[model samples]
Target chain A: MFAEGPSVFSRFIVCLVLSFLLIVIDQRQQRLESVRATLAVVLYPIHLVVDFPTTLVRATAEKFSSRRELRAANERLRAENLELRFRMQRYQTLERENERLRALLDTSVMVGQKVLAGELLAVETTPSAHEIIINQGVRSGVFPGQPILDAEGIMGQTVHVNPFSSTAMLITDPRHALSVAVNRSGVRAIAVGTGSMAQLDLNFIPNNADIAEGDLVVSSGMDGVFPAGYPVGVIEVIEFEPTAPFARIKLRPHADLAHAREVLFVWPQTPEQDTPAAVPATEAPAP
Target chain B: MSLRNLRGTLLIGLSILIAFALTVLPLPAWAQAWRPAWVALVLMYWSMAVPERVGVITAWFIGVLLDVLVGTTLGQHALGLAVIACLTVIYHKRLRVFSQLQQGSICAGMLLLYVTLLRIVDRFAGVPVPSVSYLTVVTSALLWPWLFIILRDVRRKGGVR
Candidate 1:
C-alpha cells in the first residue's frame, strides 16, 4: 500500500492529541455539553436503530398476550388502584392540614409537586458508569440535576440532557453520593454508592448513632438535588469496631435500580422557583 | 471512484451500523459481560483489511460516535480506537502474512488494550467502570476468528479491494 497524504504516524499523533484535548474538555463538567448535544442529535438515529428491536419485541409480547393474562393484569391494576384511592383519601386530609399549619406559621404552603413520566431507553449509555438513558429530553423540558424516581423511591439524577434523550447516573454508581437521614431517628449521613446496584455505604455514621438494622433511609434535601422525605433505602447491615471512628452501614436501595423500565423526572425546585412567590406577587397587584 | 469501490464503502458503513444495533439489543442479565464487543471486533477487521481508508482518523471518528452512543466522555473511545488503528497500520504487512489463529491472537491483544484504555480514561474522568471487568476480552477474542472469516469472505466476494 502507498503512503497516504498525511502518513499514518502523523495522523495518529494528531488524532491522539486532539482526542486528549477533547477528553479534558469533556471531563471539566458542562463545558463540552453544547458540543455533545449537537453531536448527540446527529447520533440520535443510531440510538433509534439500536432501540428498534427491543421495543418491537416488547410491543409484540404485549400484543400477543392471552385473554387470561390480560384479565389477570387488569385485576391486579384494579386492586392496586383501589388501595391507592384509599391512601389518596388520607393524603388529601393531610394536605389540607399541612396548608393550614403553614398559613399559621406564615410560610408558603406546598403546592402539588410535578413529575414527568419517561420510559428508559434500551441503550446502556455507560455500562460501567451506571448510566441509563431515558426517552425524555430537552424538548420535553428535562434538565440536568432533576431527580429521577421509580414507583418505589429515589433512583438517580439527570447528569446530561440532550435534545432527544437524557442520561441519568443511578444512585448506585460509584461516582454518585446522596445525603440521607434515618427516618426513625433523623440521623444525617452521607450514602455513597458501592458500585453495586444492590448496596450503598453510609459514611460517618457513628457507632452510637440511633440508626438500627431495618431502619428506613430517606433523602435529607440538604444537598438541594433530591427533595427530602423520598424513600432511598433500608439499612440492612451495620458493623462496628472498637477502634474505628464510624460504623460500616450497608443499605439496600428501595428503587429497583437495576430493572426499572420506567422513571419519573421530578421538578422539586420548580415549585419554589416559579410558583408560590410569583403567584402572590401577581395577584396582589390586581387587588 | 468505481461502482465496486462505492459499494465496498457502503458495506463498511452498513456492517458498523449493524454492530451498533447489536450493541443496544438487550442481552440476558447473566450474559451482559459475555456479549462480544461488536464495534471493537469490526474495527479490528477493517483497520487490518483496508488500512488506507480506515486509518486513525476513521477509527477516531467512529470512537466519537460510540462515545455519543454510550454517553461517555467525547474522546475516551476515540483515543482507544485510535491506538488500535495505529497498531494495525504499523503491523498490517506482517498481520496479512499470519494465519487466522495468529491474527486472532493479536486482535485479542488489541481488543484487550482498547478496553483497558477505556477503563483507564474512565477512571481519570471519575467514572469507576468495574463489574463488567475483563470478561469482554475473552468473548471478543473468541468471536475474532469467526468474524474475520465472515468479513473476509464478504470483502472478497464484493471485491472490496
Candidate 2:
C-alpha cells in the first residue's frame, strides 16, 4: 500500500508550485476575495465552536452574579440612559439649526447615517495585525469599507465581509490610516496607526502647526471612508525634530480598542457625496 | 475502500479537525505568542505514520484551510506544511526507528523551518514582521511525545494499515 503512484519529491513539487500560484494570485489581485468569502461561510461554524468555551464562561459568570449587583448595574445604566436622552434632545435642536444654516449657505445637508450594531466575536492573535471579527457581515448588509465605531469613538473599518461575519482592520493597525483634523484649529492631517494599541501618528504636520498637546482630533471625512466630525483621538505629544520638517505628533485613541465588546457598523453616505464639494468650507488643503 | 480503511481515514480527518480547532482557540494576549503549532504537529504525525497516503497534498490542503481560518495569505501555510510533509515522508523510515526524544528534536527543527519560511514570505509581502516567538516551536516539540502516543493509540484502535 505504501509503494504506489507519484514519488514523494514529485508530489511535493507539484503541490508547492500550485500553492505558489495561489499565493501570487491572491496577493496581486482581488480575484480571490469571493473565493475567500465563500470559504468563510464554511469556516464560520468552526469559529462558533471555538468560541463556545468563552461564551459558556461568560454565561456562567452572569448566572452566578448576585441579584443586588444586577440591580445596581441596571440602575446605573438607567441613569446613563436618562442623561443621554437629555443630551440627544439638545443635539436634535442643534442639528436642525445646522441644517438651516447649510440651506442658507446653499450646501447639501449632511445626511443622517444608519448603523447596525455588531458584537465582536474575536480579536486576531497576531499582534502586528490589529483586527477583529464581528458578528455582522454581508448577510446583514455589512460591506468592506463600512466604518466601525464604539460608544466612545471610531474604531476601524471592515476590510472583509463574509456571509456571517466581517473582519475589521482596527485604526491602530500599522497599515491603516484615516484623515483627521485638529478640532480646535480645523488643521487636517493623516492619522496613521503606529502598530501600538494606545497610539496613533499624525504625519506631515509642519513644525509650526497650531496643534498642541491635549487637542482633540476628529475625522475630516476627506477620505470618504469615515464620516466627518466623529472623534478619533486626542493629541498626546508633539515633538519638533531638528532634522525633519514635520512635527512628530502622537495621539491616544479615544475608542477603547483593547476592550470593546460591541461596535456600530455605519453605512456612510454614497460616493457621490464624497466629492470635493461635500468637504466643509474650513477644511485644510490636503498635504 | 474497506471498512477499516474508511475508519482510518475518518480518524485522520477527525484529528485534523481537532488540530484546527485547537489552533484557533482564544488565548490570553500574553499566551498567544506561545501557542504550539498544533496543525503542523498533526500533519507531521500523519505524514510519518502513513507517508504514502498523507503526503504533501494532504498537508497542503490542511495548510490552506489553516491559512483561511487564520486569515492570512492563502498559500502561506500551504508552502511550509508541504515542505515539512515532504521532509517527513523522506525520513519516515529512519524516524520510526529513533527514540521518542530524538524524534521530538527533529520535529522542533521542522517547526523552525516552517516558521522561518512563513516569516520570510511575510517579510517579502511587506506584512509586519512578528516578534520572535520561538517559544511556539519549543512548546510544540515538548508536546510531541504525548501527541505521538495519542495518535498511535488512535491509529491502532482504528486498525489503520
Candidate 3:
C-alpha cells in the first residue's frame, strides 16, 4: 500500500507529541520572555522588508495624485478652517468664563492628560482573534492594561507588553467589555464586542431601560482605565424580546479603529513628569 | 545539515518573518473583517510543501508566538496550530495532488478548525462564549485559494524545494 510504511502519519504523530510538551511548558508561564524578546529582535529586520512593498505603493499613489483633486481638497479644508475658527472663538470665551466660575467655587478643573503617541505596526486580521500591535512597547513606557485611544474615541487596551512592542486588544474583540453609560441619562451598562468591527452589544440593562437606537454610550470611568465621558459607541438597535428580561442592544463604535494609523496611550494616572507643577515642586523643596 | 538544507531552513525562517509582518500590516476596518489568516496560511503552506523541513513542533512554536502577539490564553493558539499542522502533514500527500483551489479550501477549513479549537480553550479559561458571529470559518475558507496560489508561487519562484 502507498501508506504502508510509518510514512508521514508517523512523523506527524511524533510532531504532535512534541508540540503538546511545548504547549504544557508554555501554558505554565515559564521563563520564555527572554527567548521571545530575542526572537522579536531577530524578526525586526524581516518586518521592515515585508512592510516595504505596501509603503512603496501608498507613497507612489500619494505622489501621483492630480493637482485638481488636491486643490478641491484644499478649498474644502479652507472652508472648514473658517468654520472651526469661529467655533474656537466661542469655545475660548466659554472656557475662560467657566474657569473663572470654577475659581469662585474653589473647584479645580482636570488637566488634560499628556499623551505618548504610537503608530500601528500590525493588526491581527484572523477571525479567531482581535488585536493590534503598536510600535511602542514596554521600553517606550507602555504598560499592560493601559487604555489606547485615537482622535475619535477609545480604541482598546494594552494586553501584552514586550520590550520592543505591545499588543492592544481592540474594543471589537469578543473578550473586550467596556463599562459604559448612556450620555443623556447616565444609565450604566456593559458594552461587549460582537467580533465584527461595526457593532457591539450592551448588557446588564433591564428591558424597560430608557435607551434608544441613537443614544450615545461613553466611558463611565468605573474601570479606572479610560477617563469618564469619552465617546465609545452609539446604540444602533434596542430589541426587546418579550420573554427575555434583558434588552438586546446593538451599538456602533465611534472610534475609527480600522483606519487609525496613530493612537495615544492613556495611563490610568498621569505620569510623574506630567503631574501638577506643585506636586513635584513640593517633593523636592529646594534640594 | 547540507547547505541546501540550511538554505531551506533560512527560507522557512524568512517566511515566518514575512508572516509576522503580514500580521502587523495596517488594514482598514472593512478590510480587517475580510483579511486572510496570513500566519496560518503561510504556516500551513510551508508545513505541507516541506513536511520534512517544517512540522508540528514548528507550528506550535509559531502558535505560541501568535498567542503572545494576539494576547490570548497562553497555549491556546499553540495547541490549535500544532494540531492543524499535524493534520496537514497527515494528509499532505492527498493535499499535494489537489488543485490550488481545493488545497486552499482545505486550508480555510483548517483555519476554521484553528479558531474553533481556540474558542474551546478560551471557554475553559473562564472567558464567556463570545458573540454568535464568532463563527468566521467560512470567510477564511473562501480566502484559502487566493492565499495558496500567492504563497505557492512565492515558493516555486524562490526555488524552495
True contacts kept of 2: 0.52
Compose the digit string of candidate 2's lDDT tens values, residues A1-287.
55533577788889989888888888777688898898888888878888777778889999999999999999999999999999999999999999999899987678688889999875353545788888888999998888899999999998778989998888888778889999999999999887788999898899988989999999998876788899999999999997999999999999999999989999877555534543222212222
Cα miss at A92, model 2 (Å)? 0.6
Worst 10 residues of 1 chain B by lDDT: B125-134
Q: Best lDDT goes to which candidate?
A: 2
Candidate 3 Cα outliers beyond 4 Å, as residue runs: A1-51, A78-82, A89-108, A121-123, A207-210, A240-245, A268-287, B15-56, B66-72, B80-119, B126-161
Per-residue lDDT of B7 in model 1:
94
Error of 1 at B81 (Å): 0.7
CA lDDT for candidate 3: 0.71
Rank candidates, TM-score, best first: 2, 1, 3
Q: In model 2, where do residues sit more than 4 Å from their true spots?
A: A2-6, A123-125, A270-287
Considering only N, C-alpha and C atoms within 3 Å, which residue pairs clash in candidate 2?
none
Over A171-250, each residue of candidate 1 has an lDDT whose tens digit, in order, gives 88777887889999999998888768899888899989898999999998777778778999999999998899999999
Model 3: per-residue Cα lDDT over A1-287, one tens digit each: 23423664565466556645545555455465555556555555544565567667877988999999889999999999999999999978887888789789876554456678998763442434567777788788887678889988899887666777777878877778777899988899888876677888788889887878899899886665666678999999888998998988898999997778789998654554322232110000010
Q: What is the overall TM-score of model 1 with all chains considered together? A: 0.91
On the 0 to 100 scale, the lDDT of residue A156 in model 2 is 94
User: Which scores better on DockQ, 1 or 2?
Assistant: 1
lDDT of 3 by residue, B103-149 (tens): 76787678777777776765555554431133346666776677677
Q: Which ten residues in a row have the lowest lDDT in candidate 1 chain A?
A: A278-287
lDDT scores in order: 0.82, 0.84, 0.71
